[model samples]
Structure formats: structure tokens, C-alpha cells
Target: MNTENDNDEKSMTTGKAQRGPLRGMNPIVTLGSAALTLAAMALAITLPEVSLAWLTSLREALSPILATYYVALVGFFLVFVVWLGMGRYKNVRLGPDDEPPEFATFPWIAMLFAAGTGVGLLFWSIAEPITHFGGNPFSEEAGTPSAAIKSLSLSFFHWGLNGWAIFSVVGLSLAYFSFRRGLPLTIRSALYPLMGDRINGPIGHAVDIFAVVATVFGIATTLGLGASQMNTGLDWLFGIGVTSTTQLVIIAVVTVIATGSVVTGVNRGVRRLSEFNLGLSMVLLLVFLVAGPTVVLCAMLVQATGDYLDSLLAMSFWTGVSTDYQWQFDWTVFYWGWWISWAPFVGMFIARVSKGRTIREFVFGVLLVPSLITFVWIALLGGTALYMELTGTGTILEAVREDVAVALYQTIGTLPMPSEAIALTGGVATLLIAVYFITSADSGTLVITTIMAHGDPEPPRLQRVLWGLGVGALTAVLLVAGGVQVLQDAVITAGLPFSAVMLAMVVGMVRALRDERFAPVPGQKHRLAKEIWTGRDEVS
Candidate 1:
């Protein structure tokens, strides 16, 4: 009867002695984070030009390193996670053998998908493919049929297995150590296999601090992007002006809504909202498939999947060596950085909901299922847009080139529907974007507060509100300074150090799994029995 929800309530109401790091909170980590965030905001506000110059320069200087590091790391994650999922360790449960899954399969997958890539997926599903079709550094010429096909394939490569593998690595490590090994549920705990009790000292504090910084910046950047997209949608739908002020107002309103949800507790607020988002997403997806070139979309899905698989290996390790490095830096590198930066937040949320699942189940569910969903989504939505462009039904490529934020609206407008139907679809799309934004913000608030509280599932309500506002405020400042590009640059930069941390966590996880304590209960017995049977059969 002890569901994940029940366990979460218990963790929150547990006595002070069992509060781990939340009893007083780590002053060093907390204050240091606050000081750095305040300083960044101050500079961005008072010396906007100087801050922009520095951010741009930093990005330029780090582009090569970021590109190389991200490409290699992401490839490694894909291979490593697949091996773990299928290897002998697959049967190792994240918790005890008798522990049933915390939530049912559907809700668990829903929550993970929502928290993992909700807003980013919504923002990019239409825009990325259209932009790629317009032009890419690769050999494919712009606006050609080849470029269109390549566009969907590249979208799949970015949002597919490699991306989710990054999340699975961190999530699997944290869940295994915390739920199975009984460590505190924090980034530091993943290092317990490597650092031992030192995880409770300065080393642990450092890991959690880096996690907090990355999560905040990642959430802030995401919020900025979502606000800009929502503002664009509103302007396209209504007559609202698209300006920084309007975006700021939008951020404020969504942040307040997110804060309210945070106060409602995770079981009620986060879980329910995630489920709702999933439902709405399905409705929107069905609308696109039904209303826009159904037969063509289906064909495109099969073709794109084949193209993606054919190019998977090349794309996985493509660092743009001996080619246009700028393309890799802009598209692939930026995505890798963004995914890594967001991993701590997304991974932690996934870990919270993934208790009691085996390593195999967690790996396949996290890496494969959600990725397949993303593939289908991109194929349907992005494919529809490309089909229109190819058939001369709409000029979506032109609109996407002008402003990526309006790409979704342009695509839906091109559907063979009446004006009223198009307007209704636009309305629904806007509503879906807004809800996705709220879910991301609130979930991020929970993750940040949890890390700060030393992995407490239920941090104080006031703390949640404070971090929620902080995220909103930082997002507003970044938007005013340089808009979505600035936010993107910031996330890429924050990801530099955290990427190293992620690598170390992967090593630690391997070490922990090798320990006898983590071996399956009947693993040795089964091995011996198989070996003896084989020998007897050979002798006979």
C-alpha cells in the first residue's frame, strides 16, 4: 500500500534527525550560490553591454572545447547506458526485491517525460526542422527535398537516444545509490561509491553546489525561451505586442502560477500537472496528424526513422572535424550543453519517481520510450511543416527563418482547415505551451530546493516560493539583456564544469554496481548451476 506518493509524504514529515542535510542546510553552498547569482544579476542589470560582451566572448572561447567534450560525452552515455541495460547487471533492482513500483507505468512515464523535456520539445518540435531545411552546414542544399528529409533526421538525432541517455546516466546512478544503498538523495550521493564518507564533507558540498548552479541557470534559460515563444504565440493569436516588457509580464504570471503549484506539494501539483500535459500533448499531436497530410506524415515517419538509423553512428560522433565547426557549435554542441546542464534537474526528478524499478526497466523506459515519443512527435509536427513546404502549400521555411518562435503557428495555419479551425488550433497550442512552461518551472523549483535542502523530497514551502521567484527574476534579467540566445549561451557555459561532474558520476556508478552488495541475490548460484550443467553435458 506504500505508493511513491505515500513515501514522499513520509519523507516530508519525518523527524528532524532524519532530515539529512536539510536540518540546517549547508551555509557554505547556499550563501556561495546566492552571492554568485546576485552578482550575475547585478552586472546584467547595471552593465548590460559589458555583460553581453563577456558572455559572447566566453562562448566563443569555449566553443571548441564544449563541442568536443559534449559530442564525446554524449556518445559515451549512449553506449554505456545501453550496455548497462542489457548486460548482466540488468536484473539489479534500484531498491529491494519486494518493493513494488512507486507509481503505475503510465503515470511514471508521463511524469518523467514531462519533467525531462516538456518545454524544450514544445519549442523545438516545429522550429528546428524548418530551420534546418532552410540551411545547414552539411552538404544538403537549402529548401530541397534532401534537405527536408535531413532536417527531420537531424531533429531525431538531437532529441532521440543520445539526449535521453544523458538523463538516464544521472538518474540511474542517483536512484541506485539512494534507494538501494540508502544514501542521501543528492548529486553527492552518486559519488558515494567513489568517495565514501568524504561525500559528507567539502567534496560533497562542492558537487551539490555545482548542481544547484547548473539547475538554476538551466531552469532560467528554459523559462526565458518559453516566455519568448509564448509571447510570440500570444502576439500571433491576439494583438499583443511582442516586446521584452510583454515577455517579462508573461514570466511573472507563469512564475506565480508555478509557485502556487510548488506550494501544493509534488504529489498533488507536479504529478497531476504532468499527467494533464501528457493528455493535452496527445490531443495536439492527434490534431496535427489528422488535419495535415495524414498519409504523407506516416510515410515521412518511416523514412525519417530509417534515415536517422542510417546516420546514427556518423551523427553520434560528428564533431564537425575538417568541416564547418560553426554548425556543430551552434546546433549539436548547444543541444549537448543544454541537455547536460539540465541533467541534474531532470535526472533528479526522474530518480525521485523511479524507485523500485530494475536497472533494465529504468534504462529502457527512460532512454527508449520517451525518445520514441519524441521521434514520433517531431515526425508528425515537423514532417507536416516540411510536407507543406515541399508541396507549395505554405511558406513555413520563410517564416521559420524570420522567427522560429512562430513556426508552429505557421505550420498549423497551413493545414487544410477553415480559418476558425486554424484559430482554434492556435489557441490550443498556446494553452499547451503555457501549461508546459508552468510544469517545467514548478518541477525545476522542486529540484533546486531539493538539492539545496540536501535531497529532502519535501523542502519548506517558503523555500520553494523563494527559488521560484529567483528563477523568474533571473530569466527576466537574461531576457532583457540578450533574449534567448543569451540564455542559451549562459547554459552552455554553466554546463562546462558540470559535464566533468557527470563523467565522474558515471564512473562512480560503475564502481558501485560492481560491489558484491549490489549483485543480484541468486546471481552466483545461477552462474554456477549453468556452468556445472554445461560441463556435465560435455562429459556425457
Candidate 2:
């Protein structure tokens, strides 16, 4: 199935052409999601402090129990993905058997990496590891050599393989149902096997509505967070004020740029920005690695990767009952919830770009490749900070503790470059953050608009502009009242229900995969390998 623009979308699914602003949209789901979004914005605007307090209290109360569920569920996702990718289901295509991928391999990966990580990797890469190193179950002591290694391992546990597996499951389920089974590419379509025709009625409507609402909130929260980071980056580099007004300005500027990208659709604007950010990210990472203790970072990567793999299961299953329970609620649980909430937005975007590929190739490319690259990034950047901290050569730990936003710029300043070169590198890092923010907003806009249009791959440009402004305004208003952080906590707490939705999706995907009429036999090892490698399964 070829992707379409909103103009083309009108005639493809509909028997006759339509016109006007709401053309090519599902009115009920669209209006319902819009209403909820507006209500959230009102809550932020009117009772900012009360909203903050309630959301905080709710998160603290629920995350303890929810963290355990998230842990168990995410661990299972990784295992399931591994089995599906390497076993009999390996050769199953996401679309028709003869269809080729929509985007080339490099561009495909670039977009995936951009949408999945974005400002997250930069915001957390150094800051998260240092915080864990300061104190965690794996590394209880503050600055011991052992503490440093295990601390990096904990970072890997959160940002590595398991997280990508979550995205893989969501995308696979949606892609399989929508492309192969001829269902609409929305949350409801993936549940067809379990829900049957009910998915076409209220049940389906509710599923799609909930996904749209959750995704809208999640995107707003991310934009708010990214705007905050950009505010800090400006102050760190050029001494621009880091006030709320500055953040509001940042959001406004980004929203405009993102709106343009969304209107242009994925291939032209989104693809180009993702590719640029990916390259700039690599360049910055290389500079950091070379400028600071190259041999030490490499050794740490090797050792920390080994440690991470060896204790993966123990860490994955740990609910912190025996260890630091509060830490579990604070860090790992928070990450899982955030990832689950984001699955709808990121998964749909990935599915749109990943139209034609085998389950095996998709799993390997989607789950493993980004994970490995992020692991290296975390190791080098965080590893460099840890080395300096342990050696007592840098004061970055002080900045990290006091203000995490400036920790990255602080790391850049401490690099062994001259003052002029240091300033140049810091500018580049700041530029990277802004680009990532743009890509994220653009991708999120595309995803939300697609859902609003009832899974039309290319949503109308008008719908995209509407959702894009809605999210930007929501973030800007919250930033004004200083409610962005509170709203983020609230939305992450809201992710609890979406976690259940994801579990249901897993069940539906399994049933669908098992129903595949012609899968290679597992006992025929040679045939299975050939089928997987050549993208042609042997029909029984």
C-alpha cells in the first residue's frame, strides 16, 4: 500500500472526493481527543498548583505497585521479541510479500533513532548515570571504582534493549494488522482478533480515543521538557536568560518550524532533519570520546556492556523490594511508564515509515541497532564524566547534582579544548538539542494527526496544523504557569492505563502471528535460515 498525502487520502478510502477543513478525519475520535486536550490545558491554566499537587500525589501513590507490573511486562516484551525474530515467525512480512520498504535502510534507521531518542538521550545521557552512580542498588557507594561500572550498567538497563523492545511490539502489532490484515492503522485495529467486530463500535472508538488522548498528553509533556532543556542550553552557551518567558519563546519558535515540517510530510522535512541530527549527534559524541580519556571510555564500554548482560535478568526482575524501593519507583518505573505512553506516538510514526519489511529484519533493526548505539553513547559520555569524578579532576558531579540541565554543557566546557574551541563545541551541542526538539515535535505532530484522521498515513495538512498548535499552546501555557514539570509527572502517571492497553496489544499480536498460514518449520534449520536471510518464507 502506498502512503498518501491528506489531499490524496480523501479519495483513496472514500468512494468520492470530499472537501473543507474536516475532510478526511474521523469526527468523533478527532473531536473527542481535542476536547480532552483542551480540558488538560484548562486545568494547567486555572489550577496550576492544585493540578501539580494532585498529579504528584497520584504518581507517588501508584508508581510503587505499577513499577513492578512495568518491570515484569517489559522484560517479557524483550523475550517475546527475541523468540519471534529468531523462530518460525521470523520470515513473516509486515506487508505484502513482494512489497519493498518505503524508505531506504539508512533513512529508515535515522528516522527511527531520531523519533525514539530525540532530546531524551542528550538530556539524560550524562545526568542519569551520574545520579545513579551517586547512589543506587548496583552501586551503593558514591565514588568507588565498582560503583562507577555498575552505575553505567544501570543506565544501560534503562535505555538499552528492553526499551526498544517495547516500541518493536507496538509497531509490529499495528503494522501487521493494518498492512497485512487490511485493518485501519489505529490502536483499535490491532485488537481485531481479540475484540472482533466490537472494535468497529464503541469498544474500538474507546481504544482509539484513549490512545489519541494519551499520545497528545505525552507529546506535550515531551515538548515542555525539551523546551526547558533548550532554555538551559541557551543560558549555558550564550548566557541567554533561562526564565519561563525564554522557554515560552523556545516552544513558539519550535512549534512553527515543526508545523512546517509536518505539512511537508515525512520524506522531505522529517527525513532530512533526522539525518542531520543523527550525523551531528555522532560528531559530538566522537569529540567527547576523543577529547576525554579515549582508552578509558573504550574499556568502560566493554566492561560495562559485559556487566549489563550478565546481570540483565536480575536487574530486570528487581522490583526493589529487597533493595532501594524508592529508587525503583523514581527511576526505572518512571522510564518504563514514559516509554509506554510514548509508544503510540513513536510506534505509529515508525510504522508509517516502516511499511514493508519482515518481522525478523524489523525486530533486529528496530530493537537491537538503536539500543547498541545508545549504549555506546551512554558509555562514552557518562563514562567520561564518571572517570573525571572518580579521578577528582572535574567538578561536573557538583553541577549534575545542582542542575542537571547544565551538566551537558559543563561536560563540554571541561573537555581538553582551548576556550575558543570549547565555545564552538558547546554551540554545536546546543544546536543538536534544538534540532532534536524540532524532529520530535514534527514527528509527534504527524503521529497525532494520523490518529486523528483515523489512521490515514498522510493526515490533512490542516489537521496537522491544528494538533501541532494545540500541543504547542498547551506546553507554552504550562511553561508560563511553571506547570510543565507537574504536567509531565501527571501524564507519566496517566501512562498506567496505556500500559494495560499495550499488554492487550501483545496478546492480540501473538494470536495473529500464530494464525499466519505459511511459516517456516523450526526443525528445518537450513530452510529457516535461508528464509530469514532471503526474506522468503517456505510455505507449508
- Residue 526 Cα positional deviation in candidate 2, in Å, after optimal superposition: 18
Q: lDDT scores for all predictions?
A: 0.84, 0.81
Candidate 2 colliding pairs: none
Candidate 2, residues 78-153, lDDT tens digits: the string is 9988998998888777776767788899999999999998888888889888888788876657778888899899
For every candidate in turn, the CA RMSD to the true structure comes to 6.3, 4.9
How many pairs of residues collide in each model? Answer: 0, 0
Candidate 1 per-residue lDDT, tens place, 377-495, comes to 99999999999988899988888778888888889888988999888988988898898899899988888878777777787777788889998999999889888888888899887
TM-scores for the candidates: 0.92, 0.92
Model 2: CA > 4 A from native: 1-20, 481-484, 520-540
Off by over 4 Å in 1: 1-24, 516-540
Name every residue pair that clashes in candidate 1.
none
